[model samples]
Target chain A: MKAVAVLPGKPNSVHLREIPQPKLNDQPHAHVCSIPEGRAVLVKTLQIGVDATDREINEALYGNAPPGGEHLVIGHESFGEVLEVGAKVTELKPGDLVSCTVRRPGGSIYDKIGRNDITSEETYYERGINLCHGYMTEMFVDDAEYMVKVPPQLRHLGVLSEPASVCAKAIDQAYLAQHRLQVWSPKRAFVLGAGQIGLLATMMLKLRGLDVYTLATKPGPHRKSEIATAYGATYVSTKQESMHDLAKRVGKP
Target chain B: MKAVAVLPGKPNSVHLREIPQPKLNDQPHAHVCSIPEGRAVLVKTLQIGVDATDREINEALYGNAPPGGEHLVIGHESFGEVLEVGAKVTELKPGDLVSCTVRRPGGSIYDKIGRNDITSEETYYERGINLCHGYMTEMFVDDAEYMVKVPPQLRHLGVLSEPASVCAKAIDQAYLAQHRLQVWSPKRAFVLGAGQIGLLATMMLKLRGLDVYTLATKPGPHRKSEIATAYGATYVSTKQESMHDLAKRVGKP
Candidate 1:
């Protein structure tokens, strides 16, 4: 199989190379192979989203090649189709679309509790971002537990799952803090950036009935601002108004 | 009333001074007084927890005096008794024990959504920490919405609420991330420090049925270590075992 890879410690050395395909395995911990033990699913890659992390990896800013491997596969945000299922897998079948999560569990209690994202040990691996192969290749396999099933109606939007998860996590924390108030009702939201993360967050906040406002450095009438308006968010140009001034104008909710 | 305050830009220049007491108000946004419209509460200070934030403020590392004030009051973690309530305040009454939340809402959508903690705008205020009077005074008033009722049984533990709230926020985020998994269960927690924040986290994780381990540089049988053990958590001395080696021994949960 041909895969996109970056040579470790070699900045801007991304290249396409032929790599050996993964094998099927019975052990749950096997990284490159489908788990034959009924808990893993073999996935054929369909789409991969390239984001800042991939650019940073290519720049040698951060990212690690697998142990003893000179090059690392480079892509994490991914959507794929399940090609095979382990004997015990019951929730999914071949041809099901799925999106694989980036961060893998580490040897921490956080991982045990399904929180590899906040693993306290600082030793967790992110697919394509560090010490692990990602889903930029023709095919890959992951434990079924780590894959989010994509609804057929939204399969085309599956590549967005990873970034959307980030927005979900942020909103979840905000709500947790708001729980301190007895009659809490968030009415307005200000998103600081107009990038994918900010736009996605704006959409989520708008869906929750909050008046959403997004600030970006770009001029008005741009595509990003258009998208924000399309999502019912008011877009502001930071070049014209300082955050402090804008915040003061907004007043307290 | 006599209050402790720090002169900004002058490290360790904390001193006692007589300050004017707050008054009742009808506007909900007034900081130091009860809302006269029956939606606020007047609180008399009962206990205050002095922690690292106070030390930093004293050292002039961070913290701001309220607008037009030369010195900032120096306390945020507080337990108080409600002395009065506005007409609209139904959740709290006179003589009830309460611990006030530190951060106040800013004029942003996050504040509207009850998420002043993660306010996207930097204009948010933390009582006694920045641009607001802290709870070090003899008496204060706040909107009833910001106070957390401290049960009579836990009044003695009330001062710990602020620090415990930090741990609560962290665990809440961790659990939110873990929700990505279908059968998430965190079995162990490793807290890196034995300071107030870490100790509180250790206690919270232990309560959640996880085998908690806290690492500190201090030798065994110390007070902090004893507290961890009392909470059913194991204390490890980092002086003896390297973190990498310890993590390897613990392995992935």
Candidate 2:
């Protein structure tokens, strides 16, 4: 199978390579295999999103290949098509749109309860990011638990699930942290960047009925700013005015 | 009235000072005065626990005098006898044992919900620590909302209530953060430090049925270690072994 591979932490090491096609077979690594046979789903790749994480991994900033392997297959944000499912798999079927969760659980108490994203271990595992192969290839097999079905109508935006989950998880945690507040009703928000994640977060916050402010470096009447304003968010460029001044002018968000 | 006061941020400034006695009357500061008169409680100080916060304040580490005042009355942990109750007071009465909550509400959303302890504002209001006079005086009057009735049987240990609440709130927050875990039943805990707060936390965790390991710098057979063991928690002296080595010996806690 053709896949993008990188020698993690080695600058400019990204290259095309032939790798073994993933299969739903019994393997020592439970994370690498679909257990009990019936809960495994084979996904065929349709779209994979490349972001800063992939760039940084290629730049030797941080990332790792799976143990005993020479190269890491890179891609964590992906939308795919379900090509096959084991006899016992009931949640998904061939031709279904889907996306895979990146973080595989470690031995942390948090990991034991399906929150592998907040693992407490000294090391972490993220497919294609560290200690696991990500879905940057033609096909991959994983436990049904890791695959999330994307509605066929929203297939075009399915590749966004991984990135959108990042924003969603952050908002979820904020609300979780505010559980102490008992009845928190935030009216405004300040998102400090105007990147993809920031824009997506602004959209999500807007959906929740918050007045949003998206801030970026350049004084922009540009495409990014337009998208933010389209979501009814005020786009502020830090270059034109400092955050401190803005906060004082508009009050804390 | 004689109260222990400090010139905040001035080293070794703690001293006995004559201050105006508190009365249940209208004042410019709502926190300083019990408003509407009917819900106020006049508390006569019985015992005050001076902890690290006081010591640090005396050392000028961090603390502030109330606005327009040169000295800050310093005592946030105290047990008191209710000397009088407002006309409309329902929760507490004269002769009742009680303790006052430390953090006072600010303008933040958290503060508005009786969670002033977790206020998000840049400045915080804790009686005796920041902008408010504390309980190190003969008597003080406050709203009944701030006074927690201590059981008569626990009178001897009432002063511990403020400190105990600190531990209870922390544990509460831990449980709250674990809401995502759904059914998290932690079996073990590792509490670093063997200070007053640490021991209190260990005791609280023990009460919750967790096997706790309380770590300290000193070697065992000391007063703190004995106290820890008395509560059925294992005491570890980090000087004897590194945390990494300890984790390997006992598994993650």
Candidate 3:
């Protein structure tokens, strides 16, 4: 299968190459075949979202990498469909649609079932980082728990789920969980940056209900900020007026 | 009273000088003047928390503050008693023990009752950031809403509240709110580092029921691992183990 490999862990380190078709065998620790055990599926990739953190990490590390490996398969956000299943596989089967984060699900069923700290207790299921393989390829395998069945409405959003979920969580953290939405909260919020993460943050914040505002540091009238506004923000400028005063005034409503 | 002031923005820009004592004056904001406010009482300071963020920002900006200079009078995160209040202030009275987060009730009563996001907004009320004040001083003011009555069990944990709350928030972010305990099962968690944040992450994960593990880049014993285990974690030397094998074992857990 074809995949992108990081040659030296640098910004320009990516090399597209063919590798041995993933052995779809069902090893005890890995599923070479989709039909391995309890609940898992194999997927053929349709799309994957590239992430900034990925770029940044690669650039920071430059070419230096951990000892044994000189090249690595890159990417995790993926959308695909099952082609087969094992006897124990239940939630998925041939041709079911799916998308999931880089994280995988592992450990005893009991541990998964009982943990109170899912993030901490989560099996180290990163596909692209700190793990054996990832799904930038034509095919891959994933546990059912890592899979999110894309509803028909959201099917268009396929592999975008990883980021959308992240945005959702950030919104939950910054507003909903913090009780930011109350009787008379600010009708507007202005995200100062116009980068990808900032845009995503703005998107989620808007979803939680703020007249979202995005600040364009340089102007081409950033589309990201516009999208943020369309979602709900009221874009602001650092040079226009004091955001502090605006926050005080607009926040009153 | 003595206060550190920044005259300009620079690494070497700080001056510890004596400033006029800030006495209770007729300020439009809430005050604890030992007067009758319905349920709230104003308190004098008993303890204040030191914030590292404050120190850096101060050194960076020579105290050439933006508008709303009054907010800089004192830092947040302190325990104090209600000294005085308007006849309307209630819920706290003088001598009631309380430890407060830097959470500002907000910019105004209109904002508060209206649930305006302004006063409480991170952009508006972020303590120690923006032009907002830090939490190191002889005295400061707080509202009943921003105040959390310290539990008897946590009485001795006074100044630790700020850091503990931060740790609590991170763990909660990583696990609790995101269904860390409910979904995304894990067999083992390898906390990549053994710093304060990492240690706290370990502890929180343990509390949530993960076989917590730690990997430190530096030389050290598993003191953090021990605390994590006490809090609930398994231990491992990240450098000593093969990450792929570790992931395989834990990913399938």
Cα TM-score per model: 0.58, 0.80, 0.50
Q: Write the per-residue lDDT of candidate 3 for residues B1-253, one digit (tens) a residue.
A: 6655454355654556565544434222332112123434345666766556556655564232436453343344566555665455566665566776554444465354734323444444444444444445555454456556666566666655666667776565454333422344455667876655677677766777777776665433556656655665655566666567677777644
Per-residue CA lDDT of candidate 2, range B7-31, in tens?
A: 9978999999997887765242465
Rank by lDDT (best first): 2, 1, 3
Deviation from native of the Cα of residue A243 in model 2, angstroms: 4.9
Compared with the true structure, all predictions reach lDDT values of 0.83, 0.86, 0.57
Question: Could you list the CA RMSD of all candidates, in the order they appear?
Answer: 8.3, 4.2, 10.6
Better of 1 and 2 by TM-score: 2
Question: Candidate 1, what DockQ?
Answer: 0.08
Q: Which stretches of candidate 3 lie over 4 Å from their true place?
A: A8-11, A27-36, A60-70, A105-125, A175-188, A220-222, A237-253, B1-253
Top lDDT: which candidate number?
A: 2
Best by DockQ: 2
Residues A19-77 of candidate 2 have per-residue lDDT tens digits of 77777652414554335667888889999999999999999898988888789999999
Candidate 2 displacement at residue B144 in angstroms: 3.9
Least well predicted 10-residue stretch by lDDT in candidate 2 chain B: B26-35
